[model samples]
Target chain A: MRRLYELLEQDTRTAGLTRVAVSTVAVLVVWQLVSMVVTNRLLLVPPAEVAVALVKEVETGAMWTNAVATVTAVTTSFVVSVAIGIAVGLALASSQALSLTAGPVLGALNSVPIIALAPLFISWLGLGFASKFVLVIMVAVFPVVVTTEAGLRATDRQLVEAARSFNATRLQIFTTVTFPYALPFIVSGIRVAWARALVGIVVAEFFGSFAGFGFAILAASQTFDTARVLGYVIMLGAMGLIGSVLFAALERRLAPWRQE
Target chain B: MSTAVRLKIEAIDKVFKRRDKPSIEALRNIDMEVAEGEFVSIVGASGSGKSTLLRIIDGLITPSGGRVLVDGRPVDRPGPDRAVVFQQDSLLPWKTVIDNVAYGLTLARVPKADAHRTAQRFIDVAGLHGFEHHYPHQLSGGMRQRVNVARALAVNPKILLLDEPFAALDAQTREIMQAELLSIWQETRKTVLLITHQIDEAVFLSDRVIVFSARPGTVREEIRVDLPRPRDLHVKRSPEFSGLVDHIWTLIEAEVRAGLRQG
Candidate 1:
């Protein structure tokens, strides 16, 4: 009965990639049907047209350059965010007074919709990679700080005490016990940060630069190239999916205790 | 100096203050002396501060009054001289058996290769030789506690403090662990201070069992177990062993009854 109940629980978690594959296929079929009925070439494009446009764009090698530009900007910003975010997180978690005072202030800052400030960054830093870098870092850093703070706080007290009893210094205790225990949560924060940085880069590119994937989307839309726009959207979706899978794998590798 | 006291707990008291409610007394004027290389166990009813007393000895917590002295030196904070084996969830889940055992040595700034070499021996002694690379969560409750012991022993401490180290194990596993602990103690002969509530465990392993009254815990009695050395499971059924267990049980029973009446 327990086994049967588990089966009937609709636990999509256990379904894994099969669920992703099924949902993607379902969405494609509906898109194809809608595009076939729409009739206007400038309106909605069929999945087949989008695939063809994606291949053509890739063949021209323009897509690769744009992809590299977007990826590099996002990756650089992500690395910066992770380094600063973890430092800020450790600082906040280590001191109660600092956390109590600065924590809500950080929350208020993060709550201000990041999209609304993208144009401001673009104006301040100008149209080059600098603005996108700053924008992406701003968007990605908060979750890493918040999640890392929570993770560090969640370190097992007994483990810390055990380390202390062995005469572990403060630094040694943090390295051996607290940090490793907080690693799984830290990885998840990085994953969230990675996705946010991608969004920030795209939005930043949409407003200013004519280089990255966001520019490709804007350029395609200007020429009424619906299929090319859809292809770029697919690329973003694929990046998101791949990023999530990579982070999940990294979490498992770093924290094998959570595997069971 | 072979017969000298290894640990001296003098007039130690602990009172936990709550903001809204009255302060609760956890331990009161606890005094005990453990001889060199002796195996001592503190057993009492719940809330009797047995674990608190052990933590004080380990220097994890400071006493409200008085202090703990090891070999005439007052213990101000946790140091490598005393190693503790906690009840459960003490092993770092991320670390492998060997790594966990090596942690204390690493903290002492022993080089990586030397730390592993020292750790490997304790891992073998703990009977966890084959599962050295496995994480703590992958191991059974008993095996994890074995690692805990190995980790404690790896530091080569002068005194070993155990806080109900087998309370989480199953009946069969607990018995096996008790025998393992006895054999380990026999091999190393470190001055051992174990805190447990199990009367039989106290009778089976300790040279002397110190029993405490319930909350605001104070030493009520200390019973000596005159059993033979290198004890096995078979010795547990002996009449003398049962008599000591019964005596400790009765002392704890009165304390428990008194606790229930107050509640």
Candidate 2:
């Protein structure tokens, strides 16, 4: 058994790809079998039917329009959240007084489920892109802030002392030592924030939106079009997978020294 | 050694106080001096607080009592006049070898081109020429420590304080680093103070080895090493060298035993 395990580990890249393919095929077969047994078009749809619906949605260009809307909202919220989150994180890390006063408040805010704010946001901003944008920012910014602050705090004390020995000023130490040391951590935080942003935009659209993946899913489900709903859900899953992969690549590019 | 005192420790005392626990005296009335162009080592047991003394001299730590003076001037804070090569590999993981070496110069606001040039010279001296662009994680443990030393030297400080800089390396690497350090010391001729528990290492590199007693550490003895200059690894085998090492070991052996009993 040990020998077999070692052999399997040798060509891990190829073996991993093959294993993924096999698992996907198994899932598809099980899904098709379940769908046939259920025999309820409203409740269940096979992979083939979902694929057909997805292609039709694409051909009609409604999927493109909804996708564009969701992507725009997510990207805008993500950019704004990262900028504000990093700035706030740096400030909190640098100032003991500010952190003492604000840390608990931020923690309290983070513990409150961001979706709970959807009604209040809609009441304030109305059922428009602005509400969705604000909702996404609320959900996404905390991870970046928490992780950035943690990273800066985690810098090795000896490194800081070495900088001090060189007579490095406070600002010089932050830019040259503290900030670069936290880059990898900040990148990982951004990845988590991206996923949260997607969730926020979708849920916001569900509450009230003229266009987006969540709106499309809600409209299809109202008519009991399970295949169209599944298509949009699958697209969201794909978007998340692609975003995480891209972020992983970005982490490697930005902090190659961290890679073993 | 020159007659001028480069660094003077005047009755320095360090007491670590905790919120609830009784304050522990780490060092008591520690007084010593390193003359100009002196290579001095402070050898003690693990809890002797030799490292604390070095940090005090570097101005990284404020002594609870007494003061540290360098060139007759009282030291209060970390300044470019003193550079420390820490026991741990403190190189910035995000920076390349060249950048880590140039860190001090950059902080001093030297032009980028001049900083890199000075850094390149030290990198070459430390035998890290081709590895300029490589990051800290990519280098071997010994190589990383070399970078640590080079970085300290690049700042051109008046005094170099090393806190067991080779304590983390394997035995073979430690010996190689010791020799390299000696050669670098010879070339630079800066006032050096090294803290270590290793008796032989202290004997081999220093012009004077000051032995510290266990807790509430105070200078127990200062042994002058008359070992001829331009020493090599073969010197360790010499009768005089072995005698000095044995003498220093004997001086600290009782302190170590006492420490063990207390713990």
Using TM-score as the measure, the top candidate is 1
TM-score of each: 0.92, 0.91
What's the DockQ for every one of the candidates?
0.77, 0.77
The residue-by-residue lDDT of candidate 1 on B125-226, one tens digit each, is: 999989999999999999999999999999999999999999999999999999999999999999999999898998899999999987899999989888
Give model 2's TM-score for chain A to 2 decimal places. Answer: 0.89
Model 1 residue runs over 4 Å out of place are: A1-30, B260-263
List ranges where model 2 is wrong by over 4 Å.
A1-39, A97-101, A254-259
Query: Residue A177: error of model 1 in Å?
Result: 1.3
Q: What does candidate 1's lDDT look like per residue over A51-96, in tens digits?
A: 9999998999989989998989888888999999999999999999
DockQ of 2: 0.77
Name the DockQ score for candidate 1. Answer: 0.77
lDDT of 2 by residue, B13-93 (tens): 999999989998999999898999999999998798999998888888899999999999998999888999999989988
Give the Cα error of residue B152 in candidate 2, in Å: 0.8
